[model samples]
Target: MWVRYLGFVILFGLPGALHAQPCGAPGLDGGYFVPLQETYSHEIEIIYACDSGRKPAVEGWWATSTCQNGVWSPEPQCIGEEDCLPPEIPNAKFNKKQNSWYNEGNTIRVTCDNGYELKNRDATAVCLNGTWTSVPVCEISNNTCGEPPQIPHAVIIGQKYQASFAADSKVRYKCEDGYSVEGAESKKSIFCISGSWSELPKCSRGTRQNTGHGSSVEVTTSAGSGTQTVGGGSGSSAGGTAGGHPTSTESGTQPGGGGRGSGDVVHGGPTITGSSTTSVSNDRNSKPAFIPVNECGVSPVIPNGVVVQTERMYLKYECNSYYTRVGPDTVVCTNDGRWSELPSCKEAFCVLDLAQYSGIGIRQTGKEYIKEGETKNVYCSYYDYVIFTCTQGRVTYTRCCEAYYHNYGGC
Candidate 1:
């Protein structure tokens, strides 16, 4: 009876073990599968899909895989020529926000920078298969300024007259003989500011008085009954006696500050004194006080980054594709006339390499590419899982298999 029972148990259990063969999760490239599970029953089928701009190698945008005796039939794969990545155009920008990839037949609008125009017939580009068409080229604009405005009594210095001048060109002028620039504060050169010439400086007929060596001379006069004093010395001397009072005058010339005073004169009628002191304080020829500029020079160069905006006191930057900024994007001009601390561009995305963690089992749907700072959960066994965070180009987390084996005995 015992022998008969043993034979029955072997026959029944052996057949059961042979039919219990289940297939492991299928690995799909360039795509993903739906209803992911650790194991698939025999003859079970699951749907699979490809990313944008790709199609199943077999046919169509989607296909199916069937589990057969611990193996998947006709391994599923997504195949495509390629995808249209963001284009790099000098002095040009896209009209819409950029994405990682563009599907076939996708269209995007492009715009040129200031003072530049698109060289292409259209401003739009279309993605055909894996190539881009109608991509724009930026070129300097043709807009120009005609001959600089003619000054009444001045001529352009070091520049010949021309029919037209390019944008941002500069033309300086000098006053003709016996003529000087009018306003105390005026720019001597005209600039092409934003495709237009700046206002021209006026040339006055009379020349400005030149006070040599920053010095000036004064004149004084006196009326009747008024005692007059003329001198360059501190102590006064009697020039003559008038109305019983002695008039004093000093002989030598004494320079006071930047001005010099001549002797005094007597006139008739009521007392009338005229004293004029002309100093070279407001003279344009005098050397002005040195003032330090509170602005920065050229912005600092950043790796894998571009300056979006630069001004006297501020600078802003943007990173290129697949790179992330590690610090503040905007920097301020410091008191030392230099830019503040700059930022750096680091790897911004990572690719999940399942082969590196092959011992661990993945339970949830996984993405091929993970952005920096993004988190995903992966499984090691039926009861063990780990959450991984992507930093720069790496994904880091404690291994779920190590914890599962130590805590749960086995899967």
Candidate 2:
């Protein structure tokens, strides 16, 4: 009976009976592999685990790598959180500890050096994850000044007395009656620097010459205002004779026309042209000013290129790769204030002339053409093999056909 029982166990339980060894897909280190001991007869799913300070490098449908046979994909790793590089603030300097790198929770201090003051509410930066907060700016004020100094025996001419002067303020002075400086004295004036006045000249007693008695007097001024001015003098008064300062072929109307209300003088073309005398009709009429070159309309805009600069009379066009400029690179301003020659950028193409070999029964398949850096395979009945390539708008060919077939053996 014992022998029979042992045989039955060996035959059915050992080799064929008990659960068969598993060959199902394996699971990751931190994943939930259901029925850890499941066999081929059943399927199992792997669900990954999550932890603090780390996240799935991949997720959603990307959770699984394909599995074949019994092998599993590489385990998905939870990457560490990232940190950002140090932030840079313009016009301001940032301070950090030596050998210190920006990481999570680190702070940076910044401040301005030049008479510059901060424009932002905060000057410190803190690192969070991979981003930084807003930064501050250092700015300088160009129009702030203090009090103007008083000089003895002199008073500012045509100037209202303001307790303090701002930057770029000017004051003119003339000696009290009968008092004057030595020979050849130019006008006496002083400009306000940062907070004080620039160097000034003294007025000493001297002789005043009147070149009026026999000489004729003529006074004239130029139209428009700004630094570009024309000041004229009479025989006895102290201004110099004003005449020529060339005008541009196209004179611009000051902004808002006749320049009555606005102070902007918009001129086109070169600097000088026309009559320098005060012809600009103190006209106060609100008519639009005339510019010479309405003729030079809008500049040409290339599809994939740009005009880097257009300051002078002539303009240049810039193009990118795979494109060629068909005309002149520079266009000069014409007499009418228009561009003399306009250029265009065209797409470069590689050309092939199979017509030259038409007698050999070789023909292009269609009316289409190939662009630069392209190639086409040709089927030549008389010659077996030929290949052609287009590069930089130039056509090149290679001959692979044998010597036995054609009149032109190779190209």
Q: Specify the highest-lDDT model's number.
A: 1
Candidate 1, run of 10 with poorest lDDT: 263-272
What are the C-alpha RMSDs, in order, of all predicted structures? 29.1, 26.9
Off by over 4 Å in 1: 1-82, 96-98, 144-181, 186-411
Error in Å for residue 52 of model 2: 76
Residue 287 in model 1: lDDT: 27
The number of clashing residue pairs in each candidate reads 0, 7
Candidate 1 local lDDT, 15-129, one digit each (tens): 8656767889988877899789988898899899998857665545678988888888767767565546567788788854333456556677888775566783357777666
Q: lDDT of all predictions, in order shown?
A: 0.58, 0.47
TM-score between candidate 1 and the true structure: 0.25
In candidate 2, position 183 carries an lDDT of 27
TM-scores for all candidates? 0.25, 0.23
Q: Using TM-score as the measure, which candidate wins?
A: 1
